[model samples]
Target: MTKQQLFDDIEADEDWLTGLSTDIWENPEVALQEHDAAEALGDALREEGFSVEFGVAGIDTAFVARYGDEGPVVGTMGEFDALPGMSQAATAEPEPIEEGGPGHGCGHNLFGVGSLAGAIAVKRAIERGDVEGSVVYLGTPAEEVGAGKVYMIQDGAFDGLDAVVSWHPGWTNAPNKGSCLAVDTFSVRFEGESAHAAAAPEAGRSALDGVQLLGNGIEFMREHVADPVRIHYVVTDGGQAANVVPAEASMEVMVRAPDRAAVEAVSDRVRDAAEGAALMSGTEVDVTKTSGMYGVLPNHTLGDTILANMEAADFPLSEEQEAFAADLKETLGSPSYADVPADRRDEAAEAAMFTEPLDAPDEGTTGSYSTDSGDVSWTVPLGRFRAATWPAGTPAHSWQAVAAGKDLGTAGMLFAGKVVAGSLYDLLTENELLEEATAEFEERKGDREYESPLPADADPYELTDR
Candidate 1:
C-alpha cells in the first residue's frame, strides 16, 4: 500500500477512533489505577489481531501490543492516565462533569487512541506487503503522576526496538527537537525526641527544626545553582501539634535540571544539606529516592522524518472545527509565546488552533517539564512531536484543556495518527533513515548506560495514591 493509502485507512477508521477516545474521556482514571482504560485498549488491540500483553513491568495498568514479526520493529507510546480533581464538561466555561472528580485534563484520552490508530495502520501496511516490519504499541499508564514507562524500561519491555515514535497533545504543532529537564523526585524524613514545648523543652530534639533548617538550606542553595535548576518541596508531615515537639517530620522534594548529571549533582548537595540539618538539630535523617527521568536525547534525523510526514500529510481542519477551537480560545486568557520563535510569536499568538508545523528549536533549547518518555529515548532512537489538541493559549491540566479535548482534541489526534503512520512507513521501508537515526542515538547517548533511579525493592504501587 502507498503512504496515501495508509492515511486513507486512518481516515476511514475515524468513527471507531472517536468512539474509543470519547469513552476514555468520559471515564477518567488516575495514575496506576487505570484498570478500565488498559482493558479497553487491550481489547481493541486484540480485535485488530495484535497480540496483547497486560501488566507489563509489574504495573497492573501497563501493557504491550504487537503485530507482525521477523523484521524491523518500530514502537509508539500511548499514555492514558488522567489528572486528579480536574473534571470538566465540553463547554467554554468551567463546568465539571462531577465536582472534584478525576479528568482527562492532559488529553491522554486522545493520546492512547491516536497512537493506536497509527500502529494499526502500520500493521495494515505490513500485511499489504508494502513494509516488512513489526508494529508495536506500548500502552503506557500513569504518566500524569507515576512514571510507569520508567519501570517498564527497567523490566526490559522496550528491548530489541529499531526506533520509537511519540506524540503529545499541546497548543502548537511542531516536530520537537527540544529537550526538557531531567528530574529527581525524593522524600526526606527526620526523627528526634518529643517533649512538651512549655515544659522540659531543652530535653527535646525537634524534628520540625531539622525540616526548617533543610528548607532554609534549599533556599540558600537557589543562588548557587544555575537558572534552569529548580528545587521545590512540601512538608507532608510537620508535627502533631504546636504544643508538642514533633517526634517526626517529612518533606517530599523534587530537583530538576537540564540533564541527568546536573540533577544528580544538585540532588547530592540537597542530601548533604539534609544530613547537616539533622546533625544540627540532633535528629536522625533518612532519604529515599522515589523516581527520576533522563532528559530526552533529541535525534534531529528522526525529527526530520516526523517533520517530513507532518508537512506531507496536509490535512487542515474544517470550518466547524475551527469555530469550535475559536470558541474555546475565547474562554481562556491569551496564550504565551515565550517558547515560540521571536519572528513567529505574532503568528502563534493570533491562531485559534495552530495547524501549521513550526521549525525545530535550536540546540540547548530545554523545556521546563519532564516526561517518562525521556527515559525511553536513552534506550532507543526516539522521535517526539506535538499536535494542537487544545486552543492556542490553553495550558495543560486545566478546565479549558478538558473542554477542548472532546472534539477539537480529536481532530489533532487524527492528524497525529496520520503523521505516525507515515513516519513509521518511512522507517520501515527506508533502511538508511533508521540507520541514521540509530547512529545519532548512539552518538548522543555516548558511553552512559541507562540506570533506574528507584531503589531495588521500590514498588510502583506506592505511587497510585500520589
Candidate 2:
C-alpha cells in the first residue's frame, strides 16, 4: 500500500483511535502502574495479528509487540504514563477530570496511542506482503519519572532493533536531530535534634539550616560548572513549623548537564556540598541518588529520513480544530503565543498544516526537555519528531496541553502516527536506509557502550526518596 492509502486507513479508524486516546487520557495511569493501558494496547496489537509479549523488562507495564520474521527489525517506542496532579477534563475551559489526580499533562496518552496506531498500520502493510521486515512496538512505561526505558535497556528489551522511530506531541512539527541534556535526580536528607525554640534554642541543631546551607553552596558551585549544566532543587521537607527546631529535613535536587560525565562530576560536587552543610550545621546528612538519564545521541541519517517523510506527509486540520487551537492561542498571552514560530502560527485566520521548520525550537520542544529517551538514543539509532498537536506555545504539563490533547492534540497524534508508519515502511522496504541509520548509530556510539544511568538493581518505581 502507498503512504497515502496507509494514511487513509488510519483516518478511517480515527474514531477508534480517538476513543483509545480518550480512554487512556481519562484513566491517567502513572509509570509502572500502567497495566490497564498496556493491556489495552497489547490487545489491540494482538487483534491486528502481531505476536505480543507482556512484561518483557521485569516491569509489568512494559511490553513488546512484534510482526513479521526477517532482517531489519524496526521499533516504534510508546509511552503511556501521565504526570501527577494534572488531571484536567476535556473541556474548553480548565476543569479537572479528577481533583488532584494524574493527567496526560505531557500528552503521553496521545504518545502511546499514536505509536500503537502506527505499529498496527505497519502490521497491516506487512500482512499485505508489501513490507518484508519485522516491526516491533515497544510499550515503554515510567517515562514521566525517567526510568522506564532505562530498565528496558537493562533487561535487553531494545536488542536486535535496526532502528527505532518515535514522536512526541508538541506545538510545532519538526524532526529533532540534536542532543538533550543528561539528568540526575537525587535528594539530601538532614538529621538534627528537635528542641523548644525559646527554652533550648542553643541545645537544638537545625536540619533546616543544613538544607539552606547546601542550597547556597550549590548556587555558588553553579557558576563554576559547565555552561550547560543546570542545578535545581526544591525543599521536599523543611521542618513542619517554624517554632520548633526540626529533627528532619530533605531537599530534592535535579542536576542536568549536556553529557553524562559532566552530570556525574557536578552531582559529585553537589553531594560534597550537602556533606559540607551537614558538617557545618553539626547535623547528619544522607545523599541518595534517585534516577538519572544520558544525553541524547543524534542520528542524522534517521533524522533526515524522518524529516523528509514529515515534510511529505499530509497533515490537514479541520475547521473546528483550527478554531480550538485559535482559542487556546488566545488563552495564552500575546507575548507567549508570539514566541511560537511564525510559520507554525495560524495565518489568514485559519489553522494551516505547518509546512516549514520553526526558526527556533518551540516552547514545548521535545528535545528541549530532558527525558530517558536521551538514554534510548545511546542504545540504538533513534529518531524523534514532533507533530503540531496543541496550539502554538501551549506549555507542556499544563491544563492547556491537557485540553488540546482531547481533540486537536489527538489529530496531531494521528498525523504523527502516519509519519511513524511511513518512516517504518521506508525502513522495512529500503535496506540502504537501514544501513545508513545503522552506520550513523555506529559512528555516534564509537568506543562507547550503552550504560544505563540507573543502577543494575534499581527499581524504577522506588522514588519515595526522589
Off by over 4 Å in 1: 200-204
Among all candidates shown, the one with the greatest TM-score: 1
Clashes of each: 0, 0
Candidate 2, superposed: residue stretches over 4 Å from native: 335-368
Candidates' C-alpha lDDT: 0.88, 0.82
**Please, what are the lDDT tens digits per residue for candidate 1 over residues 291-378?**
7888888989988999888887756477887888889888877667765678887887788887788767544588889998899999
What is candidate 2's TM-score against the reference? 0.92
250-274, model 2: which lDDT tens digit per residue?
Answer: 9999999877888999988999999
Global lDDT of model 2: 0.82
Candidate 1, residue 103: how far the Cα is off, in Å: 1.5
Pairs of residues at least 3 apart in sequence or in different chains that clash in candidate 1: none
Structural similarity to truth (TM-score) of each candidate: 0.95, 0.92
Best by lDDT: 1
Worst 10 residues of 1 by lDDT: 457-466
